[model samples]
Target chain A: MLFYDCSTAPNPRRARMFIAEKGVEVESRDISIAKGEQLQPAFRAVNSRATIPVLVTDEGTVLTENLGIAAYLEARFPEPPLMGRSADEKGLVLMWNAIAEQQGGAPVADALRNGHPAFKDRAIPGPANHAQIPELAQRGVARVAQFFDLLEERLNESPFIACDHFTLADISTFVFVDFARVIKMRVPEGNTATRAWYEAIKARPSAQI
Target chain B: MLFYDCSTAPNPRRARMFIAEKGVEVESRDISIAKGEQLQPAFRAVNSRATIPVLVTDEGTVLTENLGIAAYLEARFPEPPLMGRSADEKGLVLMWNAIAEQQGGAPVADALRNGHPAFKDRAIPGPANHAQIPELAQRGVARVAQFFDLLEERLNESPFIACDHFTLADISTFVFVDFARVIKMRVPEGNTATRAWYEAIKARPSAQI
Candidate 1:
């Protein structure tokens, strides 16, 4: 298997952390998002969507999205089961993962893409270019603030984002929370549970990648 | 098990179709999104996120997101498997499903929510009020057009969105393509492959719901 990664991107980092946790080795290559390498024709041939964190399976099937790559990895390497162990646990994992992506990741991307000068014409990712909207940048920041609150509440209930143990949900949430710094936000000083949870995940070997 | 539904919304419809396809019976109550019932305190008690198609499992666990609900049902039922039968197939299913969502559902929602007066101050979902951006509306329409082309290309390669047979990816893609009509878009006349695939999924009994 071959994995395409971007050292600076959050989505790829989630997959990277997952791979680290599974202790699986896949030939990996880095695509420089800062250099706009993903939009070039060579990478485009591999994934027409022009997104990073793609995994080409042994059979040559290209898995483009993070969810797809994670699903494949978890199924193929079931030992450390990052997704979940049971029916309800699986549901919770997916639920929290989606929440982290939608409520946390999406907003952080919006705040950065629409607010950053470097992303002036790249507010949305993919093959196409989208002009930034200042209003969206403002909304993104506000939503991210709310997302931190949501994480704090969830963490207060359980040690991890999804359940009692570390799972893919934690990986997703951890990445987004760390990435939130780009938007000049953090787990509030008062959100002790979320702050503690973030620190714990950061100490993991998988997180260092 | 109790299911909360909104007959008019596309997201809930995706879960509803999945349930119908699986031939699973769960007592369901309609939450009138049109009436802003999703935001009321009563429903808020069930799901603070103010989203619909929530499933309260037999164990009293609340599954809020569509993916979560689908994961729970797929695990419990495990027949006529919509997620896919193998590791590779599961990855492909999630990949295609996400493509349909980011490429199809999101843009459709963006166009309508930003352009339609009915969605004023409710551009983004979940217990929040966000002013719409006209630029996003324009970008969304353009993206939705590109999504049609993406679907056309994929349908030409495979009979179904993800694999040889119908699966969760088809459910997600079908709902989004149908919902695109709200933005005054349809499968283009020349895309025979996509038109045929859409027609086939539309003919399914689950779609009739």
Candidate 2:
């Protein structure tokens, strides 16, 4: 398998971390988003969407989305299952992961895309030209704070977002919480439970990759 | 099961349509977002994040995400097989559903939250106050276009987004495409395959409700 990767982006990072967690070895090829290489014709052939973190399977089938890559890997490497072992566990993993994506990661991304001067004409993803909106950044910052509070509350109830065991929920949430630093949002100082959980997940060997 | 729903929102509408598709009888309680009822202290007890489309199982476990609700319903009512039957089929359903969530549905939401004035101070989904960013709306519009093209391309290759069968991928994608109208974006006239697929899915009895 050939993994098309981007070091700076959060979504690609999630795939990379998941692969590491599964101890799966695949050839990695860096796709430089900072250099606008994703728009180049050569890269577009691999993925017309020109997004990073694409996995080309041994059969030459390109898995273009993060969840696609994760699902494929999870099914192949069922040990230390990141999705969940049972029906209910799978549902919980999907639930918490979606929450982390919608409530945490997305808000931070909106703030960056609309507020960052680097993305002045590229507020959205894909091969389109769009202007930025600075006001959304302010809103994103506020939303992120609430997301932190929500995470803290969830952590207070369970060791992991879904339950005592660390699953894909932990993977998604950990990436979002870490990515939140870009928007200048931190885990609240009073959120001891979340802080401890974050630290514990951070210490995982898979997290380092 | 009791469904905490909102009539006007796209996310909740996805759940409603899914339940309709399943032909399941669910008692739905409206949580009016326009009235700020979701943020009330009373509503927070049902869901701390205070978002709609929450499902309370007969066991009283609160399922807060769309995928969560879908998984619970699919398990209990397995005849229709909204997820999939085989391992490969399951992977495809999950992959397409996640793509619809991230690539299709999320951008429209970012556009709405950052662009809509009604969401002023409530740009985020939680109980906190945040402002809107007008620039994100432009980005969102562009992303929606790209999403359409992506969908068009995918539909051209297969009968559905994931596999040959109509699964949750179609359900989520159908909702996202329908919801895109709020952003003044519609299915492009040139996307014949996607248009045909959309019409077929729209004709389903579940889509009417």
Candidate 3:
């Protein structure tokens, strides 16, 4: 398998941390997002979406989304499962992961893309360029603040976002929370549960990458 | 299982169709989104997110996300699986499904929420209200158009979005494309592959509900 990675991006980092945790090796290709390499013809041939963290499988199938890559890797490398082991665990893993993506990841992107002048006309992802809306930045920031509280509430109830085991839910959430630094958001000082959870995930060796 | 449904919303419709396809009958409670029922304190207690299509599992776990409900149902009733039977198929199913949700579903939502007056201050889904950005609606329409091209390209390659099977990928794409009508967008006349795929999914009995 060949993994298309972007060291600076949150989505690719999620895949990277997952791959590190599983101890699986894949030929890596770096696509610098800041250099506009993802939109280049070479990368476009691999994924028309023009997104990073693509996994080209041994069978020649290209998995463009993180969920696909994770599922395939988990299936192939099951010793240290990052998704989940049981039916209930799988459901919770997917659920929390989606929540982290939508509530946390999306808001961070919104706050950055819609607010930053650097992302002017490039608010939305993909091949098309979209003009930013300043108003969206405020909304994004507000949503992210709420997301931090939600993370705290969830963490207070369970050890990990999904439950006892550290699964894909934690990986995605950890990456998103860490990437939130770009939007100037962090685990609030009062959010002890979320702060502790973030620290725990950060201490993991897989997070070093 | 008790399924909280909304006949008008796309997200809930995905779960409803999945349930219909599986032939697993759950006691359905219609939460009319048009009536702001999702925001009621009663529904808020079920899901803090205040979203519809929540499944109260037999074990009393509240499955809030569509993936969660699908995973739970797929495990309990494996026949005519909406995800996939094999590992490779599951990976492809999830991969395509995530693309459908992010690329297709999110765009339709952006178009509607950002443009429609009824959705004013509700641009983003969740417990909080977000003001609409008219500019985002235009960007959304453009993104949806690109999503259509992507769909056309994918459908031309395989019988279904993920491949030969009609799985969660097809369900999500179908619901999002159909919901795009509210934003005054539909499959372009030139996209024959996408048009045919739409017709095929619509013909399914599950789509009727």
* TM-score for each model: 0.99, 0.90, 0.97
In order of DockQ, best first, we have 1, 3, 2
Global local distance difference test of model 2: 0.82
Candidate 3 lDDT, tens digit per residue, A1-209? 89999988999999999999999888999999898899899999899789988998888878877898888888788878777666777778889999999999998999999998888888877888888888878888988899998999999999999869899999999999999999888889999998898999999999998
Error of 3 at B135 (Å): 0.8
Better of 1 and 3 by TM-score: 1
Worst ten in a row by lDDT for model 2 chain B: B127-136
Which pairs clash (backbone N, Cα, C closer than 3 Å) in model 1? none
Fnat, one value per model: 0.74, 0.47, 0.69
Give the docking tier of candidate 2.
acceptable
Docking class of 1: high
Clashes of each: 0, 5, 0
* Residue range B19-110, candidate 1, lDDT tens digits: 99999999999999999999999999999999988999999999988899988899899999998887888899988888888889989999
- What lDDT does candidate 2 reach at residue A42? 95
The TM-score, computed over Cα atoms with residue i paired to residue i, of candidate 3 is: 0.97
Choose 2 or 3, whichever is better by TM-score.
3
Residue-wise C-alpha lDDT for candidate 2, range A51-102, written one tens digit per residue: 7778887766677767778777776778778877655666677789888887
- The candidate that wins on DockQ is 1
